[model samples]
Target chain A: MTDATPSALSPLAIDVRGARYVYPTGNVTALGGVDLQVKPGEIIGIIGQNGSGKTTLTKLLNGLLKPTAGTVIVDGVDTAKKSVQEMAPHVGYVFQNPNHQLFARTVQMELEFGPRNIGLSEEEIAVRVAEAVEFFGLQDYIEEHPYRVSFPIRKLVGIASIVAMRPPILILDEPSTGQDHNTTHVINGLMRRLRDQGTTVVCVSHDMPLLADVVERVIVMKSTEIIADASPREVFADKTLMARTNLQAPQVTEIALQTVVPLGGPVALTPAELAADIAMRTGRPAAARTDAVG
Target chain B: MSMQAALPVAMIPGNSIIHRINPIAKLVWVVGYVVLAFSTQNIVVLYSMALFALLLAPIAGITKPLLKGALILVPVGSSLLALQIIAPAVERPWTPVGEIGPLTLYGDGIYYGFVLLGRIVASLLLALVMVMTTHPSDLFTSLSKLKVPYTLNFMLAMTLQLIPVFQREVGIIMSAQKSRGMKGKGFSAVLPSFVPVFVGAIERVQQLSISLESRGFGSNGIKTSYRQVRGRPSDWVIGIVGALALGGLSAYSIWRGTWNISSDIVFSPLFVVVTFVISATLFFGVVLFAVFLSLKK
Candidate 1:
């Protein structure tokens, strides 16, 4: 994982201070008050239950929503002062549902929509769309109507459409929701690739295994406030925090916490990590250890 | 207001007399109000009809929402009034009232404009009272009791139910488009957002049809409503009396030639002043509300 700390010279990718967002209808307080900072090139996961302000926080970052009370700065720009369209070039947000965004007659056109909207040159738009198409393995359905494609392909189209814009910051709201194993693998690989390219990635999801496997840091939200912000291992290891948030660690981590830790094993977040440690203790190869665990 | 609350009319739960009354009875009153409103051209009687609707607001426990909704109608009513005044249909009794820059204001046109506005307000208010107090299920069951085709009743209820759902979908669609660098403002920007909304709607309708079939909807069988509404004697009394009273008044006014007084009272100073006040309030109220909406955004 990329370092979560920002160097002194680089401005933070996302800086939020005492941010509060109250939905106007019924005065529902979606985000009460919180402070958060995200370093450039960092991969962070926000995990919380419904109405816990995870989505609200991401919305604030892209200027889809302005803080009712505090300030949000995205890449040195104040979100409150900029319209959502102005932030679009800097931050690409992929909503949870693909059906809400997949409108173009073809997947190729869908990828082109964002770059074109931000006034990119035709050649640059073509290059970006082609890159995204190849990276997401969407070439097979590139010329197919977006709505006519399978739902998982449509989800990729939704994400590739934004990724083609080449925003410095990318926010994925529940990228793994309703996704199968293969689709989840694609999303995991995409997040890593984006991080490797020095893009800041913030994902809000309820997929515990995805968060543990992919993110460097995890922010736990409860009752519209951040209850914990730490490394995934640190956050998930806290039994009180897990119980309070009504969240569980990945199954491997839960097993390690219950069985391996009592035997002086290190905290393992992923199955591979646990298998490696088990192999070391057994003085055996990791492949054989993985087989035994399986 | 949030998109979810932008429904044209919605039921507000309450235990008030209006809420407890049979929806069919309330529907009768609605029909009565419409007949009375359209039968009259007397500005005084029309304004009085509007006042009667306003008085029903408190009884229905919807005074606040009704007033808030009325604010939205201001601009619409003013535009209609202005259009009629600019070009009156009555050419014979076109007494010139005054002149503004280039166009002569006709007394008949101004009188007709206010008459139309009053009629709209009265009808709108009565409809609001019925819709706001009666739940959609109750309305459907009541109509079913009247032998309204089950299909028709279901369609009405479904339309009401889908208003909020479609509104929320549109909101999501707009946000999704905006996040992908779509312009946040202008009609051109908004036009493209409708495509996904339409696609989503088609998908939803298809799924709904499948679910309905699976649930045995519209099957040939004896169907029962979860909310059975049996009309009480009081409901019958209210429905008949209310419909008869307004219908009788409308007939009497038509017979006595009191419904049309465009030429006789068109020149009254008090009538002119009242018309001006109502129109000005609507115009300024609409402007202020528009400003408020922009500020909220």
Candidate 2:
């Protein structure tokens, strides 16, 4: 039941058993015997220092690039044997840079491309496009070219493109990067909606507290293999593991672990819970963390 | 280098039969066909070659014909008009091509001049069609497979990739200057736009060379390609047809003594009327189909 011990009972979304990959051009051994499992309908946080092969794993799951050595399965489908298009309906990946994948002249076209490719009828595609537009409040700029838009708007365009497709397993590689306060809220809200619809979301990010509050589980990879895989409470609990990977525990978890203010065990790793816990423990409470960045 | 998402010569991803043929064979066939066009002025042969090329369009999944043909079209149109216009003006030095007016004549020199223009258009059109449907990578591999000098293929691939980046940068620089009040007088502004493009282009080339080298390009090893280019019987057939067409055209000119359809050789009223009727018929046939498609779309 504790965060320290990962459960074996949950239904698995993707199962990677002993996966390995190498780049022929003087590769620094990107991944070695990497074993990872994502449970269905769970938000798994994959965190590590840069060059820890997070993006590489994202590619492997989407079948963009096959692993050199082991088996990677998404919803029981083998990745190495399938093409990106074949795996596309199941696994949707939102890449780090928004511009690289955006090819259409307008935001509406960009949103329609994936759905169209995967054989969604025009009426169905229109409905999904409408839903995405409404969700992100992107009505005014839907007709504009994504290139002409501002940075935050472009990021939303990129997200809407992926969200419109509605893939079952979504892997977001640092979705929160280059986003401000309002944009961060929008990203969180998007994830919450996907989670509500039973989409399995995996994310790799640097914003530790924000991730801890959102992800149902966390997996830490460094220098090739997984170092820790557990719920947010457990991953943030070990200050030593966080320090090794150049990450810090959520401030509330840290406060729970370090402070004399006995805010019940691990403080929930969330802003609202942290505020309530602090108010109980220390009468003079501080303001709630904004953007979930404690 | 990544900033340069270059559009390769012909990369329409499809399972079409043309895509399955070896890129080297396709290139050879295209070149052979072009050479064949220059070999003759026989109307029958040229029309046949045109028909063959047109048929291959559907097979190759060639979607952008008018745009690709536009490049050849401009040169062809200018040459035809020039031959028809200028031949009448050149006096004394001009060979008596044929008398059109008391003061005017169609010169043989102009007819010979139009030969170069006609051949260029024919060759360029065939080459453009071939380029549209084949993947750049496939063609490069096939070139290497057919012993087209690996270094040259490498150069070709890199250059093709860089063109799009150059175009995009050109776009960026143009926009930047426009915002800063550059008098964008259409073609006139194009020269000014070149200032940034030229400077940036050189830096990009050097950077690209360095990046390619860093990625272990030109290293000593048998280059292994993930996708292989394989030639087929159809490729050879197209090449032969192209070569024969060119050859027949050249031979007919020598034997029949017909350099070109002379400018001064005016068509009769009856002939002109028939030409107009035929042109109209063809035009309406195409228009009817286009209208139907537009309605469907």
Tens-digit lDDT string for candidate 1 (B170-260): 8888888988878755665654588878888888999999999999888886567998787899999999998899899899778867577
RMSD of each predicted structure: 3.7, 16.4
DockQ-derived CAPRI band for the predicted complex in model 1 = medium
Model 2 pairs in collision: B10-B134, B22-B230, B22-B231, B36-B246, B39-B246, B39-B249, B39-B250, B40-B249, B40-B250, B41-B249
Put down candidate 2 lDDT per residue, B16-51, tens digits, no spaces.
776676666666667666655665554445556556
Q: What is the DockQ of candidate 2?
A: 0.03
Place model 2 in a CAPRI quality band: incorrect
lDDT at residue A212 of model 2 (Cα atoms): 73
TM-score of chain A of each: 0.93, 0.89
Local accuracy of candidate 1 as per-residue lDDT tens digits, A1-294? 222333342389999999999987668888988899988889999998887889889999999889999889887788898888888888899999999888777889889999999898999999999999998999899989998888888889899999999888999999998888778878898999999988999999999999988999999999999999999999988999999999998999998899788899977988888888888888996774322221
Runs in model 2 deviating more than 4 A are A1-11, A260-268, A284-294, B1-297
TM-score leader: 1
List TM-scores of chain B, every candidate: 0.87, 0.68
Residue B174 of model 1 has an lDDT of 85
